[model samples]
Target: MSLTKEQLLDYYRKMRNIREFEETIHRENTTGEIPGFLHLYCGEEANAVGVCAHLSDDDYIASNHRGHGHCVAKGSDPRLMVMELYGRAEGLCGGKGGSMHIADLDRGSLGANGIVGAGAPLATGAALTQKVKGRDNVSVCFFGDGASNEGYVFEAMNLAVILKLPVIFYCENNGVGEGTGVDYAVGADSIADRAAAFGMPAKKIDGTDFFSVYDAMEEVVAHCRAGNGPYFVEAETVRFYGHFEGDPQKYRLKEEIDNAKLHRDCLKKFRSRVIEEGLATTEEFDSIDSDLVAAYKGYVAEAKQAAWPRPEALTEDVYITY
Candidate 1:
């Protein structure tokens, strides 16, 4: 809320990038251009951008299956990301890791994991590294509400608090996990309440509101930077698409989904606030969106003709055993 106009625009650009990139991938996936399963982050832009805005290139982040947004928000190259989806050799992981495992260490992106709740431990390890080196860097773990149910999440929290490691357990609660509603999966009233048991400060905010998430994470990031150990944030968000591309989504109500899209859209909300506050015009945001869409299309075209991984390199990064 205290952000300058430039910073606000930057947030808008990042959110727009994530939304466009995921929607593009969703469209391309329908054509079978991408081979692996994709957990598109269509409606969860605010969570990723808001949190990552407070982080630096020196900070670390480990993400879940719905991770493209996290990578882009954490400063991963869009072109390289597209190439990775196409299984090109020039990809972030030489296309071997595909979408679920895209990573860029230089950017402090630990990588997206296929395993549920796995990122928490990885982030804790990174936080340990920060603690050992006495660096001010913090590690953030981005997982879904489903992953919060995983046992490792609690373990990671315990370790983080015990070691006083600087980390943040960010839970993007989209209200549905895989094909099941979160209310059916989680026993507690809210996911962030678990933080109380760990003695970590927790915040539950409107994931659809960029400012809400940004304000909460700004505090959390500052706390971690001061070596205040780990904190927990449950962003009550919504996913526009199903868990994966081609999912039937029979579990979700059509009207509910439509209502969220129409009334709870983060971009629409953000734009209205910015305009209402006299911070910027709709035309300025529109211009940024136009440029992003064009650039994304160009990236998609380039990725289509990108070089594929060599057959000889199939076993290159593999760990072989007898």
Candidate 2:
């Protein structure tokens, strides 16, 4: 609410970009243009944008398989991301790391990991570096409800609390964790409760609402930057798509998916709030949406025409010499 009109519009633009980018990937994947496994970040836009909005380039974040949104919100070039997915040499990773592994260190993205629960320790280590060097920058580890059950996640939480590191253990609890319901898999009452058991401050919010996520993260980021140690946040969101592109999603009921898409869409909620508050007009939002569609089309076309990495370059950047 304290955000200016421009800030609200920027939020809408970022969320729309993520939605368009993911939807475009979904379409291109079916056509065999994008390579490898892609876990689309269709409905989880607010969580990434809201959190990263409070962060600076000095801060760090590690992400899960569904990471395009995080990369975009963190300021990675979508053109480079598209190129990466297409396996072009011009990609952020030189085409070696595909959809699941895109990283932009310059943007403070530690890269998206294919292995579940891998980002926890990575972010924790980054936070430790900040503390050691007496920097105020914090680190955030974006994991899902599925990754919450991993041992290393809990390990990272405990270490963070013990060291009082500036890190946030963010759980994007989208109800279902890759076909396994969180109810059946998560032993605790909730992911936040499980994290609270680690002696860190914890809370859960509606991830679909950008304001809710942004406000909660504002306080959390401030707390960490002030040297109050780690915090835990579980954003209960919904993914409009399946676990992966082409996933049958038989584990989810049709009505459940439909209800979430209609009632809990983050972009819709954001637009309504901004418009009702007289902060932005529908025409403004529509302009952003239209511009993104055309821009993404261009990204795809350029990526398709980009060159592949040379074979000799494969052994390059794979190691460091003394």
Candidate 3:
């Protein structure tokens, strides 16, 4: 499907938002203000924005630890996300879930999981619900290469195909899975190849290119919505930061990281493509960036002043009373 100029600009805006938000969090985390561990989604913006652009609030998505991008792409409010990171009561998840557990049911984001490979089953269950209810909506599970190696991911894939569930198993293979390289960890030729063994269609694409990811998602979404069962996508992407905040990153060389940032950055690639195709201008992109910067300033300011959850409220929302 060809994207309109407006759509192209919107994609750029979302990717830019993810980049800016992650970078801002990285800066803030250094000051010891934001509590908890943060897994920044710096270089994997295209995978989230491209895939989520094809989805709506009716569609469900389960995210992994690096999930701020998915939340932003799926239309979650960054203001509330900032507040959540700040542990403010007004934040999403009431300031309890923090970075790895931000969920907005209204937007169909099933929260980010701290446990690796946990979201696959959640999305599978959501897709099962959609099928049982006779709805056309689909569910997507965004997991990393590390999670792809987990046994439950394969179980989710086999179950989804057997039941013909409308769930897309999206894997972002960012080379390293928490300091361990994908080359040394995954025992298959590729994650997509491994997923295909479950009797579902699978494809691997250049996750760094927004257009490639978006186009492939278009086909994958159509297949699932048509009741053709599950699909798998392995996105070959990169992560700019360490596995987590404060990681020494002794596993890889500094030069390798520097080269990827300079040559394979998705934001730069998107800007160049759109401008070269005459679909967008430099000033237009610049305006969006400026607006995002100003808006983030407001979000950060409000979060700093936002209230914290009361001590007695810890028991609230922990259980349901019928």
Candidate 4:
């Protein structure tokens, strides 16, 4: 279905939010204000926000190491996220998780996993619980193409199907898996096809297009929510940053990155579509841009001044009732 005016505005806002948030992390990390290796999701904004638009607080999502976008889209607090990146005690997970493990259970975000394909099982388990309880809630597992090759992901899929768990296996195919393209690792051209082999519903969509991803996800999510079992969606996307903060990205060609930026930019495409449909005015978008600039600047300033995590927290949140 074509997006309405409100949906269009929401899509634009989310894509822009992800872009701005990632860009902020990039700038701060480069200046040595934020600690640890950070992978910015500057270029793949739509894939996260679009797929997540159909979800709710009752629903769940599992994220990859590059998970800030998913966290924000799933309704995480921006201030806490920034504090987490800053390794402050007020940060999410009490600054114990850092960039790779930021999570808020209250918001239904199942924490970004450090090991590839690790989140699939967690999401599947969540879905299983929801299913046993007869809840309509669904779980979405956000993994990269690289994670698609993991044995755990495969096992999770089979288990979810056997239990008829309402889970969506979301594959963000950003062309490369930390330098090696999916083509080099995955034998199939379509990740969705692989999901079908496991006897589940599957489809592929242009991850760079917000409306396309949103519409497609609505269908898949609906099917899953109706107790039709698990589904798979492969989003064709691209990341502008290196595997982490400081890697040289020598495996990729400069020309390829530039080309993706020009043709496959999700934010640019969202702007064009909204403008072309006359559903939103350029002035409206410009207003959002202005607000974003101020918001990001404010977040960075506050984060830089926030207190760092205390050494005593090293043993906290590791185990319950230990």
Candidate 5:
């Protein structure tokens, strides 16, 4: 489905937000202000923004360690996100979740997981809740290609299909799971083939192209929301950063990064498409860019000034009701 002018602007805004947010995190991480590890989603912006464009707060999403993009795309506040990264009292999780465990359940973001393939079960459980509640909401499970190799992901897939749950397994195959390439770790040429083996319909799209991911998601999400059980989408893309902020990236070649930036930047590809199609004007795009820069800068300033959560509260929220 082609996006309307308003939808185009929204998609562009979300993508820009993810980009600026990551860059801000990188800057803060360098200054040693951000606590714990951060897995920035610098290059793979399209997969999150595109798929999430089709969702609302009523729908749930389970995110992996590299989940800032997903959280921002799903309407979690950016200022809160920055505060969370800074371990501030104003953070979404009140500085408790830090980077990897940041979450806002009211917005339907279950949480950003620290464990590999952990999101699958949570998403499956959410789908089950929706089914039992007789709600027409779908759940999205976002994981890396590396997480796809885990037993939990496969088990979740089987359970989701068997129960005919409304879930979409979004595999952002950015070629690597940590430092190892997905080709070396997954033991499969394409993740779609694996989905097919489980009797699930899967689609593979170029993750660097927003329209490709967005358009494909429109179809797949609609199918799942219609009680067609789970659908799988494997997005082929690349990440510009290493496994972590301070990673030397010794495992990857410099040429790969250069190639992705030059030819496979998803935001660039999206901007080009909307302009070429006359769906959005260049001035509109520029205005959005300017607004995003200002907004991100403001968030960074506020987050830095915000106080960290109280030391006494560190022991809170360890159990639900016990």
Candidate 6:
């Protein structure tokens, strides 16, 4: 790996932060502390961290509903994020936008969208702006295996390729699109093949492996930054959680879930790799995790204590009455 020990450890902490934050919210949602529905990004940490590691704060990323990991990977404050989940006044979107729509434009996070495949166009637009303005900054569009089949996604890809925009189509193909399998929805033999048809650099990677995801993304990000056109990456990841917090998941096999947790967990794979490479120790990673637990604990607690958005502010950012 070209990454330093310090860099690998930093990635570890970022993944841990996402895992802990999602698990915490999963528990808190049951007690009603976290408002609104959620699509937890429990097992897709590597996909987000790997790609975002190559992006700057000036580079934009558009995310889907399962977006906490993306936001954390891109440097959104965990405290404000937790507050957003709680619909507090000080949240990321001033509490109006919950889990599905957390935007931090200053951080270049376009937002966690509710509409599937919508972020692709937004990222495309960001990339177009960069290209037109002669900026080297690239934009990343993180979507799911399901959204990969969306018409808007293909449209965005076509535009991006034709315009030679600096955008990366990062598809977290978790095999399951909500409840239906990817094979059912995506007519293409492989989702990445869609990009292949467009003559874009398409890679199908093992998303459970941090190094694998990171390395692939590093090359793509580098290429895009060098003024190359858009690329497509299909990361074969696993979603440890169901479609939603309360999803019965009748479609999922318990054994598959167990197998994924045991053998395909990104955190486990990452920890093993780092330790084997002599880059870090188990105790060292655990220490970082301890701090993460405390930080998330504080974030959730502070969010609980935060005030709600004022009633008068409800219509404040809605429209133009003049």
Instruction: Write the residue-wise lDDT of candidate 3 on 88-156 in tens digits.
Output: 999988998999999999999998999999999999999999999999999999999999988879899
lDDT of 1 by residue, 21-86 (tens): 998998888888889889999889999999999899999999999999999999999889999999
The segments of candidate 3 whose C-alpha lies over 4 angstroms from its true place after superposition are: none
Q: Give the TM-score ranking, best first.
A: 2, 3, 6, 1, 4, 5
* Candidate 1 deviation (Cα RMSD): 1.6
Write candidate 4's Cα lDDT for 1-322 as tens digits.
Answer: 3667887787788788888888888877878877787888878889888878999988999998989999989989877898888888888877788999998899899988789999999999999889889999999999999999999999999999998999999999898898898888889877778987899888899988887788899899999899999998998888898999897999999998899899899988888877887778899999988898799899888877888777877777678887
Instruction: Name the lDDT of candidate 1.
Output: 0.93
Stretches of candidate 6 above 4 Å error? 319-321
| lDDT score for residue 111 of model 3 | 86
Total clashing pairs for each candidate: 0, 0, 0, 0, 0, 0
Return the TM-score for candidate 1, rounded to 2 decimals. Answer: 0.97
Off by over 4 Å in 1: 319-322
Give the C-alpha miss distance for residue 256 in model 1, angstroms: 1.0
- TM-score between candidate 3 and the true structure: 0.98
Q: Tell me the tens digit of each residue's lDDT in model 2 across 1-322.
A: 7899988889889999999999999999999877689898988999999999999988999999999999999999999999999998999999999989988889899999999999999999999999999999999999999999999898999999999999999999999889999999988888899876799999899999999999999999999999999999999999999999999999989999899989999999999989998989999999999999999999999998999999887889867973
lDDT of each: 0.93, 0.94, 0.94, 0.88, 0.90, 0.92
Give the runs in model 5 whose Cα sits over 4 Å from its true position: 320-322
TM-score of each: 0.97, 0.99, 0.98, 0.97, 0.97, 0.98
TM-score of 2: 0.99
Worst 10 residues of 6 by lDDT: 313-322
- RMSD for all candidates, in order, please: 1.6, 0.8, 1.0, 1.3, 1.3, 1.1
- Error of model 6, residue 246, in angstroms: 0.2
